[model samples]
Target: MAEHAGAQKGDVICFGHTHKPWHREVEGIHFVNTGSVGRPKDGDWRAGYVILEMSGDQPRVEFVRVEYDLQQVMEAIRQSELPDDFAEYLATGGIPRPVESAADAE
Candidate 1:
Protein backbone atom coordinates (compact mmCIF):
# COMPACT_ATOMS: atom_id res chain seq x y z
CA MET A 1 0.00 0.00 0.00
CA ALA A 2 1.84 3.02 -1.29
CA GLU A 3 0.28 5.90 0.59
CA HIS A 4 2.15 8.33 -1.69
CA ALA A 5 1.09 10.78 1.06
CA GLY A 6 -0.82 13.02 -1.34
CA ALA A 7 -2.73 10.98 -3.91
CA GLN A 8 -4.99 12.66 -6.46
CA LYS A 9 -8.08 11.49 -8.35
CA GLY A 10 -6.00 10.36 -11.31
CA ASP A 11 -3.58 8.80 -8.85
CA VAL A 12 -4.80 5.39 -7.68
CA ILE A 13 -3.83 3.32 -4.66
CA CYS A 14 -4.38 -0.42 -4.43
CA PHE A 15 -4.42 -2.55 -1.28
CA GLY A 16 -6.14 -5.51 0.44
CA HIS A 17 -6.38 -6.64 4.07
CA THR A 18 -9.93 -6.26 5.33
CA HIS A 19 -11.01 -8.68 2.57
CA LYS A 20 -13.85 -6.31 1.79
CA PRO A 21 -14.54 -4.92 -1.67
CA TRP A 22 -14.37 -1.15 -1.91
CA HIS A 23 -13.68 1.60 -4.43
CA ARG A 24 -13.89 5.24 -3.60
CA GLU A 25 -12.35 8.62 -4.36
CA VAL A 26 -11.71 11.08 -1.54
CA GLU A 27 -9.84 14.32 -1.64
CA GLY A 28 -9.02 13.60 -5.27
CA ILE A 29 -7.42 10.29 -4.23
CA HIS A 30 -8.58 6.91 -5.50
CA PHE A 31 -8.70 4.09 -2.93
CA VAL A 32 -9.28 0.49 -3.91
CA ASN A 33 -9.50 -2.69 -1.91
CA THR A 34 -9.25 -6.03 -3.79
CA GLY A 35 -10.81 -8.01 -0.95
CA SER A 36 -9.67 -11.66 -1.14
CA VAL A 37 -9.27 -14.29 -3.84
CA GLY A 38 -10.25 -17.31 -1.73
CA ARG A 39 -12.37 -15.77 1.00
CA PRO A 40 -14.15 -12.41 0.81
CA LYS A 41 -15.85 -10.28 3.45
CA ASP A 42 -18.27 -8.62 1.09
CA GLY A 43 -20.81 -11.37 1.93
CA ASP A 44 -20.58 -12.67 -1.68
CA TRP A 45 -18.17 -15.50 -0.76
CA ARG A 46 -16.44 -15.32 -4.13
CA ALA A 47 -13.00 -14.47 -5.45
CA GLY A 48 -12.76 -10.70 -5.67
CA TYR A 49 -10.53 -8.49 -7.79
CA VAL A 50 -10.21 -5.01 -9.23
CA ILE A 51 -9.62 -3.87 -12.77
CA LEU A 52 -8.03 -0.51 -13.37
CA GLU A 53 -8.09 1.04 -16.80
CA MET A 54 -6.11 4.17 -17.39
CA SER A 55 -7.42 6.32 -20.23
CA GLY A 56 -4.90 9.11 -20.68
CA ASP A 57 -4.42 10.90 -17.30
CA GLN A 58 -7.73 9.58 -15.92
CA PRO A 59 -8.39 6.06 -14.58
CA ARG A 60 -11.33 3.67 -14.54
CA VAL A 61 -11.80 1.05 -11.86
CA GLU A 62 -13.94 -2.08 -11.74
CA PHE A 63 -14.47 -4.60 -8.96
CA VAL A 64 -15.05 -8.25 -9.86
CA ARG A 65 -16.06 -11.17 -7.66
CA VAL A 66 -15.88 -14.71 -9.13
CA GLU A 67 -17.76 -17.71 -7.86
CA TYR A 68 -16.12 -21.12 -7.75
CA ASP A 69 -16.29 -24.55 -6.09
CA LEU A 70 -16.30 -23.39 -2.49
CA GLN A 71 -16.67 -27.00 -1.41
CA GLN A 72 -13.18 -27.77 -2.69
CA VAL A 73 -11.78 -24.83 -0.82
CA MET A 74 -13.37 -25.95 2.41
CA GLU A 75 -12.01 -29.43 1.86
CA ALA A 76 -8.54 -28.04 1.40
CA ILE A 77 -8.83 -26.12 4.64
CA ARG A 78 -10.03 -29.19 6.48
CA GLN A 79 -7.04 -31.13 5.21
CA SER A 80 -4.60 -28.42 6.16
CA GLU A 81 -3.49 -27.61 9.72
CA LEU A 82 -4.92 -24.12 9.65
CA PRO A 83 -7.21 -23.03 12.44
CA ASP A 84 -10.88 -23.98 12.17
CA ASP A 85 -11.76 -20.30 12.38
CA PHE A 86 -10.21 -19.82 8.95
CA ALA A 87 -12.66 -22.32 7.47
CA GLU A 88 -15.47 -20.43 9.11
CA TYR A 89 -14.28 -17.23 7.47
CA LEU A 90 -14.20 -18.94 4.06
CA ALA A 91 -17.61 -20.41 4.65
CA THR A 92 -19.18 -17.14 5.75
CA GLY A 93 -17.33 -14.54 3.78
CA GLY A 94 -14.24 -13.16 5.57
CA ILE A 95 -13.79 -13.27 9.36
CA PRO A 96 -16.81 -14.40 11.34
CA ARG A 97 -18.72 -11.65 13.11
CA PRO A 98 -18.71 -11.17 16.90
CA VAL A 99 -15.05 -12.01 16.91
CA GLU A 100 -14.38 -14.08 20.01
CA SER A 101 -10.96 -14.13 21.57
CA ALA A 102 -9.21 -17.19 22.94
CA ALA A 103 -10.01 -16.13 26.47
CA ASP A 104 -13.65 -15.64 25.55
CA ALA A 105 -13.80 -19.20 24.22
CA GLU A 106 -12.29 -20.41 27.45
Candidate 2:
Protein backbone atom coordinates (compact mmCIF):
# COMPACT_ATOMS: atom_id res chain seq x y z
CA MET A 1 0.00 0.00 0.00
CA ALA A 2 1.06 3.55 -0.74
CA GLU A 3 1.46 5.48 2.46
CA HIS A 4 1.95 9.20 2.72
CA ALA A 5 -0.09 10.09 -0.29
CA GLY A 6 0.46 13.84 -0.14
CA ALA A 7 1.06 13.36 3.59
CA GLN A 8 3.36 15.46 5.70
CA LYS A 9 6.23 14.33 7.91
CA GLY A 10 4.02 13.67 10.95
CA ASP A 11 1.53 11.44 9.14
CA VAL A 12 0.53 7.90 10.08
CA ILE A 13 0.80 5.08 7.53
CA CYS A 14 -1.73 2.29 7.77
CA PHE A 15 -2.05 -0.62 5.33
CA GLY A 16 -3.08 -4.27 5.13
CA HIS A 17 -1.95 -6.81 2.53
CA THR A 18 -0.31 -9.60 4.45
CA HIS A 19 -2.81 -11.52 6.53
CA LYS A 20 -0.73 -10.93 9.63
CA PRO A 21 -1.34 -7.65 11.50
CA TRP A 22 1.38 -5.44 12.88
CA HIS A 23 2.17 -1.94 14.20
CA ARG A 24 5.46 -0.20 14.60
CA GLU A 25 7.19 3.11 14.21
CA VAL A 26 10.19 3.60 11.99
CA GLU A 27 12.13 6.82 12.33
CA GLY A 28 9.27 9.25 13.06
CA ILE A 29 6.31 7.99 11.02
CA HIS A 30 4.02 5.26 12.34
CA PHE A 31 3.44 2.22 10.13
CA VAL A 32 0.50 -0.11 10.67
CA ASN A 33 -1.53 -2.81 8.98
CA THR A 34 -5.28 -3.21 9.55
CA GLY A 35 -5.10 -7.00 9.08
CA SER A 36 -7.68 -9.16 7.30
CA VAL A 37 -11.41 -9.26 7.89
CA GLY A 38 -11.86 -12.62 6.18
CA ARG A 39 -9.53 -15.65 6.20
CA PRO A 40 -7.18 -14.12 8.72
CA LYS A 41 -4.73 -16.96 7.89
CA ASP A 42 -3.13 -16.26 11.24
CA GLY A 43 -5.13 -19.28 12.49
CA ASP A 44 -7.31 -16.89 14.50
CA TRP A 45 -11.06 -17.30 14.03
CA ARG A 46 -11.79 -13.62 14.48
CA ALA A 47 -12.37 -11.49 11.36
CA GLY A 48 -11.60 -7.81 12.01
CA TYR A 49 -10.01 -4.45 11.32
CA VAL A 50 -7.79 -2.06 13.21
CA ILE A 51 -8.40 1.37 14.70
CA LEU A 52 -5.57 3.80 15.42
CA GLU A 53 -5.37 6.97 17.40
CA MET A 54 -2.71 9.21 18.77
CA SER A 55 -2.81 9.25 22.54
CA GLY A 56 -0.44 11.89 23.83
CA ASP A 57 3.09 11.01 22.73
CA GLN A 58 2.30 7.46 21.59
CA PRO A 59 0.03 6.01 18.90
CA ARG A 60 -2.58 3.53 20.09
CA VAL A 61 -3.75 0.67 17.88
CA GLU A 62 -6.76 -1.55 18.44
CA PHE A 63 -8.00 -4.59 16.53
CA VAL A 64 -11.73 -5.16 16.54
CA ARG A 65 -13.64 -8.24 15.31
CA VAL A 66 -17.38 -8.08 14.95
CA GLU A 67 -19.55 -11.19 14.99
CA TYR A 68 -20.91 -12.01 11.55
CA ASP A 69 -23.24 -14.69 10.21
CA LEU A 70 -21.05 -17.14 8.31
CA GLN A 71 -24.21 -18.79 7.09
CA GLN A 72 -24.99 -15.81 4.89
CA VAL A 73 -21.60 -16.04 3.25
CA MET A 74 -22.07 -19.75 2.88
CA GLU A 75 -25.48 -19.24 1.32
CA ALA A 76 -24.05 -16.74 -1.11
CA ILE A 77 -21.35 -19.15 -2.05
CA ARG A 78 -23.94 -21.88 -2.54
CA GLN A 79 -26.14 -19.66 -4.65
CA SER A 80 -23.29 -18.42 -6.78
CA GLU A 81 -21.65 -20.43 -9.56
CA LEU A 82 -18.47 -20.86 -7.54
CA PRO A 83 -17.18 -24.34 -6.87
CA ASP A 84 -19.03 -26.37 -4.22
CA ASP A 85 -15.79 -26.87 -2.38
CA PHE A 86 -15.76 -23.15 -1.60
CA ALA A 87 -18.88 -23.51 0.53
CA GLU A 88 -17.33 -26.62 2.04
CA TYR A 89 -14.34 -24.51 2.96
CA LEU A 90 -16.62 -21.89 4.55
CA ALA A 91 -18.55 -24.53 6.48
CA THR A 92 -15.61 -26.49 7.80
CA GLY A 93 -12.74 -24.03 7.47
CA GLY A 94 -10.81 -26.97 6.14
CA ILE A 95 -7.66 -26.42 4.18
CA PRO A 96 -7.97 -27.03 0.49
CA ARG A 97 -6.15 -29.90 -1.22
CA PRO A 98 -2.45 -29.71 -0.64
CA VAL A 99 -0.01 -29.35 -3.46
CA GLU A 100 2.33 -32.27 -4.06
CA SER A 101 5.66 -31.96 -2.32
CA ALA A 102 8.80 -31.89 -4.47
CA ALA A 103 9.92 -35.05 -2.70
CA ASP A 104 6.83 -36.84 -4.02
CA ALA A 105 8.06 -36.25 -7.58
CA GLU A 106 11.43 -37.88 -6.87
lDDT of 1 by residue, 1-106 (tens): 2455264434777888888878876666678887788767767777878898988766788888788888888888888998867777887886457869999999
- Superposed by TM-score, candidate 1 places the C-alpha of residue 16 at a distance from the truth, in angstroms, of 1.9
Among these predicted structures, which one has the highest TM-score? 1
Which ranges of candidate 1 are over 4 A from the true structure?
1-10, 95-106
For candidate 2, what is the total of clashing residue pairs? Answer: 0
Angstrom error at residue 45, model 2 = 3.7
lDDT of 2 at 15: 80
lDDT of 1 at 39: 67
Kindly report which residue pairs in candidate 1 clash with one another.
Answer: 8-28, 9-28
State in Å the error of residue 80, model 1: 1.8
TM-score of each: 0.72, 0.61
